[model samples]
Target: MRRHGWRWVLIGVLGLLVTGCFAPSGPRFGDGSAVPEEVSRVRLPVRPGPDGTWVVNSPGEGLLGQGRVLVRRAGPDRRGWRLALPAEFALTSQRPGSAHSAFVGDHSVVLVGGREGRRGPSEIAGLDLTNGRLAWRLRVAPDSRVFSYDEGATVLVADCRAGSCRLTGVSYPTGRRVWSRTAPGAVKVLDGCRADAFVADPVVGRAPCHPYLVTRDRVSLLDMADGRLYERPGLRIPPGGIDRITENHGRITLATAPAKGSCRATVVSESGGDGAQDLGWRYTFVWDQPQAPRDPATGCRWDRTLPLTVVRSLVLPDAEGALVLDPYLGLRKQLRRLAPGEYLTADETRVEVVHASGRPDRPLHPTRTPLRPPGLSPAARFLTRLLWQDGRRLVLLDHQNRPLWEAASACRAFMGDGEGPGVSLTYCDGPDLVTVRPAWKD
Candidate 1:
């Protein structure tokens, strides 16, 4: 949960927050009336492509099958060309056991191909967006998430969910399996067949000790250099005890709920960096009632290593900004842990190193550039989107974030793709799809 005089807020699609009542004269959709049948048709507007070209997937935004990728290039007005799938490739999620899904890529799109029987392996196919031709077709035991080799690269890493699943790198143009190695557990990749997914964090170090994976039991790290996994000599995640585990520079923070005490975290070093010491006990639950959106410091581990000098109660103020905490990487806001030790904080102007015991230890990282990834904690999203629409004029709360700029309501939602820059915020007003450019600026 969270406590904040400076609380972080998240909102609908593109995660904008439209606060403070607007004057009736604020720019708004002309009438409460919906747009014509043509405009209201289900089409998922993707991040705009370069040179006035845009890609949109349709049949209403969803993970299941039922529409084609509609490519919209700027004409006298935006017109749809090249429907990615036709009658022959019409998709349906109806299956006996497996649920169908899809993931979109830069040059290709992948989806669960139609299957014949109720119980069988999951069939997937990738299509060349350029020609709307099938690039490759492969099958995973169950489901998968997409991963890419690098930015602007075509290679896709499908994180298949076959518990104890291994890594199999396939050639982009040809679906032939290139490299395969067994790790610990099933590789949990990010998305299905409609949106694009990329490597959240690339492997690091001279030997590359990353390509993170989570097993049925514990989280595992893979070394891409040799296909060998990292071994933690002193680390042992007590079975059935901790709810979540996170790693940062060989450090582990455990989020759990004990039968007796309130929900708390125990920080331990896997590499004996801190000599296997117990960092300290911090309770995530405020007032003994769980906070709506969990403050990351209470639940996940931050990417930054906690300084040894600051042992307890580190309070980092947001200074009026949003923090998105990944289940693994802590908070996008990155406060991480709060109160009881010294920690760092930031604002539009500067990043301050605050100490619970005293003052500054000299500013560690500066402002403007956050040391951590700004993620969307599921709690924050559920909590901040308390009220979105007010009467007619639809406005998005400009959290002033660079990576995102999409909007969602009961009426419609546009998915955000940090896959590339120039976030074009697209929102729907009845039948009309409106696009907003320059997502964030001065």
Candidate 2:
């Protein structure tokens, strides 16, 4: 009897220990704050996928490893899926856009890998999103860089050495070689501008039709299907090395910064001291115009800084102010008098200040009660949504800057439309992939 009683007591103690290990200690929200009932959370180790709808885990070291991938959707039910990548091979997402590393096609999630373990060649793997199966694998040149891909095809720039690069294409799902082309000069691909120019080719389906390749001397468009080169002589390469390129309304703008180590010491008369700092420069070019590119500003501004490229706006930050380009790729205006803790961001509509705390300095849209204390009220009939980055945490805010929801992120990046009703913010939070839908209406 005593032995039986002791065994029962031991089992009860073990049960309590297991429960303590798995039970929720407090709240998932940062700083011990209670997570609101409307907010949702999921825990998985991952990075942001190609789009806001999914997230994929980073690969382990070697040519053959395994990890997990997840796809999430937004709605009342918030249904989604997850799959552990097959252990037969290893793959990783590279050169991601917004928050995506691997390309999520209509049918599969494609990932690229470099030679790591005993593998001799670089390769790409396609995993079926439906059943978590490895559908295809293709060995590519060790130096090749995948520029664009989809369910229809994959395009890349290969053998970029000895002053030239080769454009190559491969068929989808089958991993068959299709076509390749050799270019004359060192090729640099401008990421966002597709050679297809935003139009879907009827033959290529929705795959990235072609990639825009720029060289030391010219800008040329590559044909992804047959490797045809369409050279545009109208696009001239302006003086000062092109550091960044963006396309808007058929016009291409390239921003240039001061040459490396081109700093001149300045005299401080009050203290009889001299100091030197790097300067920044800006340049803009056109697509079909015959004239040379324009240099609108020249001064010792600051160290080299990359242009903040957006869909409709290009902003070059200077020590004095920020130069904003209009929709037509022309100088719109220079924003001045920025506060010390403020950062500038311009969309198609207006210039706004992102405060140091990650919240905007003011409401993005018209506020129904600008002076009222924030928080949802019974009389509130509408709500505006905005995303703020507080360190590694993503905060969802309303028009009045009230935080409706929050989550941590590993990449500190966000994707999807915040202004829309159903669009969700998908990101990775260390070992967890999270998606939060903003309450866009009262």
Candidate 3:
């Protein structure tokens, strides 16, 4: 635990640096010939364009203009730079609280703000990605936090007012509150735990004990759609106490350590239309150093005290953060291809490949199949990149969960497209948005 102390601290520091930028590898081109390099640092509004180009436009008041300002997508492809958006456009946001952002479907972008007392997100706004036109903006709660997005341009937000928080489903380009329900508390959806809309009751204002079981607060799951909420799989609190409840994809997990030093977890799958619990599995591990937690030497042996179905993998720690595993010997098959000492994070259906050096391993070619692609209740499929946009910054980390690089600007707007080596992104330093294509120095 002492040896791994620095890692935990570094993770906290790097969490803020998730969105990162690259210093373009110089003179390189997707084409065979290396010609004069395009200057990436410019005083223009920029965005990543289709086909493999960077869109740049002359400055305007608060948007990109057509007559006074020219827009063009520039790249080495020689496709004759395409005309960029004619309407005004600016990734620079005026809302408060990191400008909660998400892309709608594929043609629109959304930025939301509503952190009480702080710089408030006066409105939740969406824009046409291609034309840079105003799509819609909704007036939201002063303390609203947009968590995830839909395939289209929709968002799920936590609107906390007075004392209770409501999980509201609102559509973009129309700012309509399609569905909403009072949330249990500050329950967060994890990246890999994989629960779509179903959230555990994060009992607030109560003791750290299991309030759902004691108070019998309804255990419910909300559909991420513009639909309804359902109460299903009424769960019970185990003996010891619940360490926490997390969901990724569609998998909902309730964890406790019944024994003194054992880690017991109950995993529940979302019911299929009907109100059945669907499938529930249980796992237990007696970590060698439970106090340390996340210890690589902490061998996982199923308690077998309880029963489980469709056992997937045991999560263990690497030198960096942690990795997922199958119950059998060695590592999980999904991580079989990883070199010795390398690590991987399993969430939803994707496996992130890590190298022994604790850096994200981007193979020359693309990676396809997931060693153990599991089904889920929530979470969308994403690329295998180390960093992504959070508001105006690229939130990225290194293999050891350290900051990859710091941005040179205050960051006004940011966006990441695709996943893995194919992942591309753009961010703003005021109005100067820089595009970063996933690539590495050999």
Candidate 4:
């Protein structure tokens, strides 16, 4: 007994030491008492047509205009360019000269060559940020979308017209085509992982529309480095159907509605194998109704209605298996299990239950209690968007979701640009990077 007690004591001490080293310092909130210092304003150069329709920089070092193509610079001295296609080339609406603009970090002054309503053949041109000189130009089809870039070496372009599509890997400096592959049908670029890009085609069978009309609804993995294509199995979702697919840890996870009209999720390993053989575990939510009530005080409008089925929002960390958030039964639950493989099912799985505070007595309640532990305060939850794991400790954020303060140090905070009407606070943290933004009216 004495020997066992000594061993346990040593283990506990070692655990404490490890925890102390990795423990994150508590969060710090700005006192509501004092008015925040003003941030400086900068007058960005106005483009030709629209006064403010140019581009706005988001919270991070990214530029957001039309789609998810948020471009950022590799470094402060480095500049990145994006060739925007003409509105006629776009499947959607056009935003003036923004039809061709290179997002150089937060500064969106670089204008490439493309007219608002122009169609057919177009040449790509980018304004240099360093010396205000013309960078490079390339001839491209009207319907081409610039997918990615690696400095000046290569740029991937996806040209889609009608129901036919072709992906070309082009050398930027020489305007020479490195390699090109034409799919049989309209292809949608899904996601990029590692050095490969995943695309899916939805039209199969004999269609006499374009050069590649017979090959739709098929998934293919293409090597970005060389434009090599690896065709995967056919995805037979219903017409006009969409699936949420994400790639993490070299594995592809797809959530789709099964033919039986139930939501299902499948995980596929990067290793090539039979398509059906690669299906991972499947889960079905048993709720009679999945949608939350607009007013928690009022119970679901139709208790007698059949339960709606939906896939839970799951976040899988590289090392921590899968974390599924089940916001049902008035409580939030988390499921953690080994990495799911093909043919696995969520049956008899042990899940940790996070109970909400207070019981629902009335038909609806104003404040629905949290399903998770109270360890995360309201501010922490609001700042969850900015919370990312660094090592073991989570990097905390300010109220604005900016990474102003890391939880590593208790006393130090990182403040960003303080010029205009934007709120700015001093930090005991390291030197701040001052960025200018347009003034905002209260």
- Worst 10-residue lDDT window for candidate 4 reads 341-350
Q: What is the alpha-carbon lDDT of model 1 when measured against the actual structure? A: 0.36
- Give one digit per residue, the lDDT tens place, for model 2 in 1-442: 9999999999999999999999865432222232223344556534443332233432211011123444333334332444455333333433332112355444445666554453332666665544445677776665556655553466454557667887667766666668877777765655443322221111133222345677877766667777777665545565554544544434444544443344222110011112211112223321111111222343333422223543344444433333434434243244333333334433312323232334434432345544223542312222123444544555655444666566666654443343433244455666765555433233
Error of 4 at 250 (Å): 4.4
Extract clashing residue pairs from model 2: 44-431, 44-432, 45-431
Predicted candidate 4 versus true structure: per-residue lDDT over 93-155, tens digit per residue:
232122444423233233334545656335554434444344556767775655433233455
Top candidate, metric lDDT: 2
The per-prediction CA RMSD against the true structure, in angstroms, equals 16.9, 19.0, 19.2, 14.9
| lDDT of model 3, residue 401 | 40
RMSD to native, candidate 2: 19.0
lDDT of each: 0.36, 0.44, 0.38, 0.36
Return whichever of 1 and 2 wins on lDDT. Answer: 2
Q: Each model's TM-score, in the order given?
A: 0.42, 0.54, 0.40, 0.41
Off by over 4 Å in 3: 1-44, 47-100, 114-122, 130-133, 160-164, 179-219, 234-251, 254-279, 284-314, 318-323, 327-442
Clashes of each: 32, 3, 35, 23
Tell me the deviation in Å of residue 425 in model 1: 4.3
